[model samples]
Target chain A: MTQRISKYQRLKMMNPILQFFRFIYLSIKILIVVAGGHGGTRNIKSSTSSS
Target chain B: MAKIVVLGAGISGHVAASHLRRKLPKEHQVMVVSPNSNYQWIPSNIWVGIGRMKSKQILFPLAPLYKKKHIGFKQAKAVTFHPEGDVTENKPYVLVEGVVGDSKGKQEKVTYDYLINATGPKLNFEATEGLIPGTNSTYSVCTYTHADHAWEGLSALIADMKKGKKAKILIGTGHAKATCQGAAFEYILNVEQELRRHKVRDMAEVTWISNEYQLGDFGMDGMLLSYGDMTMKSHEMVEMIFEDRDIKWILGAGVQKIENGIAHYENLDGEKKSETYDFAMLIPSFSGHGFKAFDKNNKDITDKLFKGFMIVDANYSPKPYEEWSVQDWPETYQNPSYKNIFAPGIAFAPPHSISKPRKSKNGTEIFPAPPRTGMPSGITAKLVADNIIDTIKSGKEQLHHKGSMGNMGAACIASAGFGMTSGSGVSITTYPIVPDYEKYPKTQGRQLGKTFGEIGLAGHWLKLALHYAFIYKAKMKPFWWLIPE
Candidate 1:
C-alpha cells in the first residue's frame, strides 16, 4: 500500500527549485549587507539579519 | 625573526594560524602541529551521521591549504610543553610525537617565541563505562568516523523498522557534566525527521536524555526571546516542540553506566533508573588533550591546568555557585604563569559553568558545562592572533584586546533535515552569551531585544549556505579574510 503524500512532502519534493531561489535570495542579502558596509567577514557583533 | 607555534589544527587553531600567516611578515614563522592531516568541519557531522552528506564533503586535507598559505604544518600530536627549555636551549618549546605520514612514532621538539594552545577537547569516552565507540553498546556523532559508525547503526535499525519491527532510539549527552547539548538536540531532530521521511516514524520511540536542568538550557542557562508580544523562556519553547513532536525527555539526568541496550542513570531526585534503547548516540564529556607542562626547575607546572585544561586569566579560586561572578571568567586568554602562552577555544579552562549548578540528593553534580562552539572559537582565535600581531609588530608584548564570551554574541543554526523545501532548522542568536545580571537586570539575564530564535525552511537554507561558505573561507580562497569570523 502506497502512503498518501502530504502537502509538506510535495513541497519538499520540489526542494531543488526552492533551493535555487533560496541561493539567489541569500546571495542578494549578502550583497546588500556588504554594500551597506556590514560584510559577513567582519568581526563578531550583536546584530540581526534574516535570510 | 620570531616563531609562533599553534598546537592543534582544529577550528580555533586553524583560524589563529591563518590570521597570523596573513598578518605577520614572511621573516616571522607561523606553524601548526596537529594529529590529523584532514580538517573536519564538525558542525556538519550531524548531517553526516544520518547519511544526508558524505564525510568527504565536510573533510579536507590541511597540508595543501597550509602550503598555499606558506605556513608550516606538522602532522603530530603535542605530548608535552616545556615553558623552561632544557639545558641546551633556554627558549620555550613543545615536544610532539608524529601520528601521521612517514614521521609516525617519531618525537621532535618544536621551539617557539609564542604559543597558542587550541588543541580542542579530548572526548572522554572512558569517563563513563560502556561508552567507548566501536567496542561499546552506544554510538557517537562527535567525529566524522563516529558519525559514520552511527549512520551504519541507524541504517540497520531503519532496515528492521521497514520489516515491521519496533525500535527505541536514545539520543543525548553521555555524561553528567557534558556540554554541546545543541549538537545532540540537532541530531535527535534530524533522526526524527529522517524516520518520518522513511515512513517509519510511528515504529520508532525517540527519547532525549541530558544533564540540562530543563529543556533548552543549552549550557548558557537558557535565554529569553520575545514571541508575539509575550516573553518566552527557552525551556518553554523547547518543551512545546518536544510535546508537539511526541518526543519524551528525561532532564537533570547523569548517565552513570551503559550495558548492552540498557543505560543506567541518576536524576536530580537521586533516583536511579534504567532506559533501554536499540540504537543510541550519546555525546561524551570533554577534557584537556593531556599535554604535560614543566617549569625551569624541572618541576611539573601541569598543576597550572585544571582537569587537563590550561588555566588562563580566569579567577580559579574555589568558590560556591552563589559566589561565582563574571570576574571569575577569563577576559584575556593569556596564561598568567607563562605570558607568552594563550589557550583559546576548548583548550582554556572555563572558570565555572554557565548553567546554574545543581547537585543530586546523593551529592552527584548534574549540570551542563559551558560550550565554546565554532563562532566564539573563531572570534577568540582572531582576537588572539590580532594581539600577537600587535606584539610582533611592536616587538613588545602588548595584550590590548579581549574576546570574552560574556561580551560577545553568537549565531547558531540547528538543522533538522537536508531538504531544500521540506527541510527545517532552528536559528538562534544570543548576545552576551554568558548571562550578565547587572547589564540586563532581567530574570533570564539576557537582553530580550537581542536574543532571537526562529524555526523554518529558511534556517535550513542558511545552514547549507554556511557549510559551503565556511569551507570556502577555510580553504583560503580569494578574499577569505574578508569573511567575518
Candidate 2:
C-alpha cells in the first residue's frame, strides 16, 4: 500500500501543469504554516499561566 | 553576578545583545559597545545604494532602544582586547578608542566579566588602489557615508547619461578575499534596473568584477535550485538578464587598481587587463584586525584570530572538501577558550572554506568565508544568546548551540525590480546543505526539492513587507517579541 502511494506521488509530478498547481498548493500550505508560526521555532511562554 | 559586554551594533551585534538582554538576569549587567549611535538593517543597503531609501529610514538611534531595555550602550570602537588581566596592575579591560561625540578619538577601558567580540568585517578600502580615490578612484556603499556618496555618484552618472553622454559603471568587490559578494551583486543589478528604467541604459555600459570563482556563489559553496546545479548555471541566468539590459561582466577577476576611468583587473588565469568605467562601486575585503586577547602567560592572542574578524569558539583546521562533514563545523558558537565568549555572525570563523579552501601556485592559502546572510546570522545570534542564558541559569553545561551554515537551509530573494510581483523577485531556497555525499557523492549542497525563482507581483510585496516587519522586530516594540527571536 505504501509503494502504491509512492508511485502515485511520482506520477503526479509528471504533468507540468499539475506540478505547478501542486507547487502552489504546497506553498499555500507552507504559507499558512508560516503565517501561523510565531516567527521562530523557540517555544513561547507566558508569565501568568491561565490554565 | 556575571557581567557581559557585546561589541559592535550591526545586525549581528544587535541580535546578540537584544536577545542577551532578555536571557540574562535583570541584575546581571549587559552592555553594548559599538562605534555607531544607530542600528542599521544593512540588508536594505542595496536599495540605499541605488537611492531608493534614505539613510534615516534604514537606521535608528541605538541609544533610546537600549534605554528602554535597561541596557547600557557605548558608542565607541574598541582598539585592543586584553583577554588576560594584567596581574601586575590587577585590572583587566579592553582598551577602546572612542569615536562618538567630543571624545572624538579618546581612548578608554571597558572591563567585563565575559565578552562577545561581534565586531564584524572591516571594509578595507585601503586594500585596493584607485578604487577609493584622492588616494583611490571609485565610490563605495558599505556604510551610510559610502552609500550616500554612491547615491550621489549614481545620480550624477544618470544626469550625464540623460544629457546624451556615455556612462560606464563598474561594480564588485575591490579584493579577492571579500565576503558579502551578494551585496555587490545586488547593487550592480539594481544599478542596471535603474538605468533601464530611466531609458538611459542604452547610453550606459555596466561591468562586474569579482574574485568569486563564479557568479551567484555567494560563498555558500554553491547552492542548488529545484532545477539543478544553479551555481554552475547562474552565469547563464545573469548573462541572459544582462543581455536583456545590455550589461556585461569580467568574471573571475580581481580588481588591482582604479585610476579615474580605468580599472585594472586580474583575470581568472591571473592575466591583468584594464577596463574603463565612468562610475564604479567596489566592496573591499575583510581582515580580523588581529584583536589581542591575553592568556595567563600574557602571550598575545592575535595570531589565533583571522584578519578583521574575531575568532570565535570554532574548530579551526584544514579538512579536505571531500571529507567536509557537517560534524566538522560548529553548532554552539562558544569560544573555545572561554565559555562566556561567543562569536556570532561574520566575527566567528567557519572551520574551513565553504568552497574547498584553495591556494595559489606559490601556496598562498585563500580561505573563502561560508556566507552567512543577514537573516541567518541574526538567527545564530539569538540561538547563541539563548544557550548562554540557559547555561547561566542552570549552572550546568547547557546544551551547546548548532546553527551550522552548512547544515542549515537558507533562502534568498534577489530582486530584479522593486515591484509587487513574483516576476519582480528572484528567490531560491536550498536545504540539507553539506550535500549528502552518501546520497549524492558527486556534489555539495545540492537541492533535494526544486529551487526555482518565480517572477510575480507577490514576491515584491513579501520583500517590502519584510522590510517593515524586520524593522518593527529590531526596534523591540510590544509586538516585537511576537515577531520572533
Candidate 3:
C-alpha cells in the first residue's frame, strides 16, 4: 500500500511500451464514441466490450 | 370489483394506489395502509441531514391526499402476513398490528383480492454496531431523523476541529454488502467542500470506506466514460476527484467492528487494519426484510419473496459472476405463484448484484449490493400498475412490464449546495445502469456525457424543479398522472 506508482508524474514520463498501449486504448475509446455518439456510444460499446 | 390493498404509503405504495384509481373504476376499492400518514421525499434526506432543508419540506401528510382522491387510507405499520385460510379456512386475511403513535390505527384483519406489498424497506439504523447515537461510534443517513442526527453530529465534529483539534472524518459503509455508494461519495465531497468553506480544511482529514472492489464500482462493474478525449473510469474518476479534494479512501474492505471513534477493517488481501476517526458516517448494507410464512405443500414462500416483493418469472439462479449476462434477466416482472401480487421498490430484489461479491473460502459473508434507485422504483410501479390493469381488463394476467435493470437508464441529480451558486449542483445520467460490459467492454456499463459533463446553473434549476415537481405529483393534486410516473 506504500507509494509505488502515482498516476501523476509517470503518465507524463511513460516507457515506450506503456505509452504505446495507452495510445491504443485511447484510440479504441475514441473510435467507440465516434461510432455511437456520447449518449449511447459508451453504453452500447460496454455491452459488446464486456465491462 | 376486485379490491386491491396497497401496503406502505411511501413512493411506491402511493404511486400504485393513485394509478390503481385511474386503472380501476370507481366500483373497486383501492386501500393504502402505512404507519406514517406523511409521504417523505426520501432522496432529500441528504439536505435534511446537513441542515439544508427542514423535515417538513420533505414530508407531506398522506391521509388528506388519499381522502381527497376517495381512496381508503389507514396509517399503520404492517407487522405480519398470514396468507393461508388457517384452521377453519373461514376467512382468508392477514392480521396486522398498529404502530404506537398512529391514532387512527388499531389491531385489524384485512382481506384483499390482490395486495401490492410496496412495503419499501425496514430501516435498521442499528445494522452496523456503534452506528447509533449514545454508542458514540459512527453516524448514518438511512432516514430523515438519521440524516438529521448525522448533520448534528457533523456540526459538533466541525466545532471540535475549530477548537484547534486535528480531526479525521470517515464516511462510507463499513459493510461490503452495502449499496448506495452514490450517497457516500456525495457526502464525503460535500464535507470537504464545507471544510474548505470554513477555512479549516487544513486541520481536518476526510476518508471514505466502502465494500466496493473499487471506489465507483457501486455494485455495478466499474464503468469508464470518455469525455472530450479524456477517458475516466468511474472508480478512477471518483478517486481522482477525491484526491484532488484531499480526501482518501479504503476500497475492497469490509468492516470488522466500530468501537467509539475507532474503525477496524479487513482489506481485500485479508490484511486487517485499524483507523481512528474524529467523526464518521457509515452507510449500512441493505436487504429485504426476509420473512417467510410457508404454504401447505411443504413449500417455502420466503425465499420466493422479500419484504412483500415476490420473485416473478425472473431467471433467478445462483449463477457465478463469469456466466452472468443481460439475457439471464427477466423480461416480464410477474409473480409466477400469485398473479395479482406485484412489487415495486427496494422490496423487490435484483436478479443479481451489479458488483460481484467475494466471499471467504469458508463461505462467510462479504461484499453485497444490487444498485437500484428511486427512479427505477417509480418506473417499476408504473409498469406493475399497467400489467395489473391489463389483467383486469382482459380477464387474464398479461405481462406488460418488460423493462428490467438491464434495459433501463438511471438519471440522478446529486445536490451539492441545496441552492443556485457558482460551482454548485451536478446532474448525472447512466445508460443501461447495469453495464453491458460485453458491448462497451472498456467502460463496463457507462455511457459518457449521458449528461455527466453538463453540470452548472441549469442543472441547479433542474434539481430545484424536480424537487417541487415530484412532491406535487406525490401529493395527488389534479393532473398528477399527467406529471409522469
For each candidate, report its DockQ versus the true two-chain complex: 0.09, 0.04, 0.04
On lDDT, the candidate that comes out on top is 1
C-alpha local distance difference test of each model:
0.82, 0.65, 0.66
> Judged by lDDT against the true structure, how good is candidate 1?
0.82
Q: State the lDDT of candidate 3 residue by residue for A1-51, as single tens digits.
A: 234326553343234444344335433332333222212122333433210
In the range B89-179, model 2's lDDT, one tens digit per residue, is 3445778887867887899878887677778776677777755722233777778768877888888889989999997788877776666
Q: lDDT tens digits, residues B1-485, model 3? A: 77788888777777888888877888888888887767898777777776677888988877777788889987676655545535544433455667756544577877777777787765554566665642564877767777888888878877888888898998888675777877776677667767777678999878888888777676666566543357666666566556666778887777767889998877777777888987888877776555564443335555545523457556677788887776555444555666666677666756677777686444545675776667767766666776677777788876644556666666666554444443244445566667766755655655555413222334444556667888988977778776654
Candidate 1 segments exceeding 4 Å error: A1-51, B305-307
* Comparing 1 and 3 on lDDT, the stronger one: 1
Q: Which is better, 1 or 3, measured by TM-score? A: 1
TM-score of each: 0.91, 0.84, 0.84
Give a tens-digit lDDT track for model 1, residues B26-84: 99999999898898999999999999999999999999989888999999998888988
Pairs that collide, model 1: A40-B484, A41-B483, A41-B484
Over A8-47, each residue of candidate 1 has an lDDT whose tens digit, in order, gives: 8446534666645644654454333222221111122432
